[model samples]
Target: MSMLEPQAPDLRVQKWIGADGESTGPLKLSDLGSGPKILFAFQHWCRGCHVHGFPTLQRLHSALSPRGVGFAVIQTVFEGADENTFEKLRVNQLEYALPVAFGHDEPLVGATLPTFMEDYRTRGTPWFSIIDAGGRIVFSDFHLDADRIVKDLELV
Candidate 1:
């Protein structure tokens, strides 16, 4: 890849917080199974995350997981530190009935934003990023078109 072509940063997230259901570890982007992977960035306190973000993610996961699409959820806590605690990761995971791995992201020592947010350059909670089969971030934004994703993955 050319230097000008940005590559997907290796995922450096907090521990994989799991409750009951099975989940993959605090893995890098390359660690995800071969095929496209979706990274759902959220915060427990964000109503938008529950009302829109997760529902969007759930549709994508339910439709594409069986088709070899990998999924991971990260609670990037740039704010609401008390409400968006590590414990809430599992709560959201179970609440959504999403069986994929969940991560908790807090600001690193001396840093204002979590590692994932800094690496991905995310704006805020309810962000979504998609890493392609070759580990390239094909899409990164706050809003998603669940139907478009489902249709697009059908082609992939």
Candidate 2:
């Protein structure tokens, strides 16, 4: 899907642990409040996501989080994977401190990256969505501009 389209309004997510054993949420963009929330959907195995998307996500989180913007990430694994390769992928090494969840978790609601592509009609990784405190989506994109997100928040 092109980044310009609005995301599904009723999209729901759940909470679960990541490969690092940390608590994470299958959160909806609307649920983010008290300040703006930025959601970054990613997969551990996507090379572009790891090299470019995540680093940009980190920068956005670091700069905006303190200013009351919440950041969350979803790290997905393909449904048909063996333990060896899945175990080799690490979510903790990615440089952001946001809460994270994985597709393997029980509460995923089948919203993994592959599922999101089919369900949300998006084609790739690093899908970003910005939701306001009232739950209305303000901006959604496949590409993120770290400086732009941070700068925009300063104005809010």
Candidate 3:
């Protein structure tokens, strides 16, 4: 349930809001397909997420999506449910102009954090989890430098 590493992911994230601002399914990791993928977790109200996370992810997506990399965004609601409302999912997506699958992950019944946060051991907002084409979590952390990922991709 904890300590996610580089391996086939047992993705259990429940609920999602698709890119087009509509209710969507409980998204699975496989929904991103079999190519390399990036998941950006954030809170709608998190200042750092807007200042650093979104920009970093946007840059990465712009550079990598053309190369066949997949991208998704999740509002990992750990606090301030009032501010991190599900409606913000589309608001942010449109604001950022990120045309990719966006998700809203709230803690399940009786759970303290969302399934993705628990499974990935995410510390807080502005987190990035990178999975390789092999479905392995090659990188998971709060700070992700797009440059590093680009270099890593070039080497791959």
Candidate 4:
């Protein structure tokens, strides 16, 4: 969202699915305080997300999760509500072998955009963001550069 200072965005997730594929109930960004945090925004029906975004995330998680980088996935259902249902959160987690907390940010009001997309000012799916341990927005972009992310994670 073109943040000038290092500030964490409001995590307005409607539902949550834990790493164990179980409901975690509602949660906020403050709830996750385990070192560096990486949040990946995707939609199940997005072809690019399935082909590239998720694979990149998986690799990033493989490399950083061991290094104490907390990972989370948010299904920002900006479109394709039928395809990107909350049930797919679990399915995608298992399918992608992602053992990280997953969130379902459904659209509100007249069904325009999900809370994450609107609050984070995400253009569309395949968005990625990172917050350092100090709760600063270190990285936010549509492209995922694994090496750059690893470098940024060091600041946390």
TM-score of each: 0.92, 0.67, 0.91, 0.90
Positional deviation of residue 136's Cα in model 3 after best superposition, in angstroms = 1.2
Q: Write the per-residue lDDT of candidate 3 for residues 64-87, one digit (tens) a residue.
A: 888878788888888998999888
lDDT of 4 by residue, 35-101 (tens): 8788899999899999889988998899888888888899998778888998999999999999988
lDDT of 2 by residue, 31-138 (tens): 444687776666655777768887887788777877888665654444423431333324443344444343331124554444444444445566777776655567
Q: How many residue-pair clashes does candidate 1 contain? A: 0
Arrange candidates by lDDT, descending.
1, 4, 3, 2
Please write out the lDDT profile of model 1 over residues 47-104, one tens digit for every residue.
9999999999999998999999988889898998989987787788879999888888
Highest TM-score scorer: 1
Off by over 4 Å in 3: 1-4
lDDT scores for all predictions?
0.85, 0.57, 0.83, 0.84
Which of candidates 2 and 3 reaches a greater lDDT? 3
Instruction: Give the range of the ten consecutive residues with the poorest summed lDDT in model 1.
Output: 16-25
Q: Residue 53 in model 2: shift from native, Å?
A: 0.9
RMSD of each: 2.1, 4.8, 2.4, 2.1
Q: Which stretches of candidate 4 lie over 4 Å from their true place?
A: 1-3, 154-156
Off by over 4 Å in 2: 1-11, 18-20, 23-31, 76-90, 93-120
Q: Candidate 1, overall lDDT?
A: 0.85
Clashes of each: 0, 3, 0, 0
lDDT of 3: 0.83
